[model samples]
Target: MKIDELHQVFLNYPRVCTDTRKIKPGDLFFALKGDNFNGNEYADQALEKGAAYAIIDEEKHTGKQKILVENVLKTLQNLGTFHRRSSKAKVIGLTGSNGKTTTKELINSVLSKKYRTIATSGNLNNHIGVPLTLLSIKEDTEIAIVEMGANHQKEIEFLCSIAEPDFGYITNFGKAHLEGFGGVEGVIKGKSELYDFLIANEKGVFMNADDPIQKEKLKDYINKYGFSTSDTKYYQIRLVEANPFVVISVEDTIMGSQLIGEYNFTNCCAAVIMGKYFNVHLDKIKAGLEEYVPSNNRSQIIEKNGLKIVLDAYNANPTSMYAAIQNFTKIEGGTKVLFLGDMFELGESAHEEHQKIADLAKELDFDNVFLIGQNFYEVKSGFKKMKSFDDLKNHLTKYSLPNSTFLIKGSRGMALERILELI
Candidate 1:
């Protein structure tokens, strides 16, 4: 069947589910295949779970409720793109090496105050995820915050072709996904694709004036934002403090946020600036920023069992891990105990980068330091090394550090947050 026909069917159902286990009655199920599993095999299971239609690409699975397509993933992407083009909502496409998700959430929080909005769920900002997010955009949504993430060059450009955003923002470039993107230079070229999209399309840009790289890249662009009262800046915001939460002064107003760390300060500033650009009142913007709270183990502070815990285990790379360590050291309280987990996706640079992180940790004056993961095993540091979280827990079973402040962080796969159960 044609894409138009499939889109019509999607319009009728208006819900997309990839997992049969999560499928709801009347939802459209896409049999998407992944590295290890073939979703075509689960097409019937999706229908049995009450999905209105099971979109399949395998000819053998095609029949009755199972709608056959040439390619299941490609079909879903097309459906998402088709839905995006048909929407009247103004789209904001954003990408970066770091802070993309937080910035997306901040923008969504601020914009949702004045406009009906939907953002990319969690970290679903990839090839399949972007389309899923775009397809989720409702007819009444005034703004769509489509976040695009990439490890290699041109990936953002491809996502842009699908999202076709009216505006763009690139949260600062950082060292991440080095395995997929060739090197640091590759990281820059890859993330700058968002700027390329906006510049090529003549769409508005939300530039950060405080960032010299952003200033240079967006120097030719007119639309911009930052923390200074510059002639070229569209909005100005100043960071007051970022201890346990972000506190900012925006023009005549002061906003205190529930988010933590200095990295998040930029994220909040971007939101306030974008809110003002979209004509949202400063008061509403402040309220929205204040209402927003950090979750999913990204910059969350929990005090329990007389110990202060900083959980930032959602993800980690060289740049973000460095920033997290910098901020964790500054917080004044009980004895600081840091559990630094290995940064992933460094590829060939894993050893060197992990050594750098170990070196940085030694330079810092923390009370106790414990390093986990195989990447850190060979790194020379004064910090104690644990092969895994279980190893750390085994040590803790013999000895406990109560009433001490702890910074627990690692890549998502590390599950370092489980350390909370011990503390």
Candidate 2:
């Protein structure tokens, strides 16, 4: 069936499902295929589970309730684009190397105070996830915040065409996805695709004026709003301190947050600026920021058995890892211990980046540092290094460091959060 016809069917059964196990009655199911599994094989199961329609690309799966399409993925994308164009909600497309998920959540929390808002759920900011998020927007949604993540060139640009955002924001380009994007320069060019879209379409953008690269790249864009510490022309906010929790002063009001790390200052500032732009009351914005607590091993502070722990193992790269360590240095207390794991996706530069982190850890004033993973183990460092989690687990089980402040961080694959169980 054509897109318009499918859209008509969607208007009746608006709920879209990808998994047969989660199929609800009167829901439209899309049979998405991957290398390991073909979703077409489950079309019959979806129909049995009461799916209104099962969209599939395979001709063999065609039936009374099964609709055959040239490509199921493209059909889903086109349908999402079609629905977005028809939506009354103002779309805000967000992309970046680091803090995209956290920034997106912050913006959503602040904006939802006044407007009927919907945002990308969790870290569902990829190709399939973007379309799914757009499809989830309802008619009553006044604002939609879509987080876009890219590991290679033109991924953001392609997602932009689907989301068709009226406003855009890039968190900051960092040494992330180095293997997919060639290097730091490639990271910049890849992320700036959002800027390219907003500029060409004459859309508004929210930016960090404190960043020199952001200012230089957006010099020619006319429609832009910024937040900074010193620039009075835009919204001004200052960081009071980040001892364990972040405290900030904005609009003559002091706000305390549950989030730790000075690097999160920019993330919080961006949310405040977004709230102001939408004319949300300063009190409501403060409430939103204050109520939010970091989760999913991202900058979470936990006190257990007299030991204060900073769990930041959700993701890591050279940029974020450095900032986490630098923030750890400022916290005043007992013996500061760091359990740094290998950062992934660095490609050929993995060894150098791991060595740099090892060297930096040596120079810092930490009482103990333990490096985990193969990359860090290969690096020539004096600190206690482990090639795997079992090695670190065995050592930590024997050695007990009481009343110490622990900073545990690494990439997602490393699963450094497991250290909490050992401790």
> Which 10-residue window in model 2 sums to the lowest lDDT?
213-222
| Candidate 1 residue lDDT tens string, 1-423 | 899999999889999999988999999989889899999999888888899999988998888888889998889988888898899988999898888888899899999998999999998999999999999999898899988989888999899988888998888889999998898889988888888888887888887777778788888776545555454444667778887678998886889998888888888888987898889998999988988877899888998889988989989999999999999877877888989898889999999999998888889878899999999878888688988888888988887786799998899889899988886
lDDT (Cα atoms) of all candidates against the true structure: 0.87, 0.92
Q: Each candidate's TM vs. the true structure?
A: 0.97, 0.98
Q: Residue 7 of candidate 1: its Cα lDDT?
A: 90
Expressed as tens digits, the lDDT of each residue in 206-273 for candidate 2 is 99998988999888877999999998877899999998788999978998888888999999998999
Could you tell me the lDDT of residue 90 within candidate 1?
A: 89
User: Which candidate leads in lDDT?
Assistant: 2
Where does model 2 exceed 4 Å of error? none
In model 1, the runs with Cα more than 4 Å from the true position are 223-234
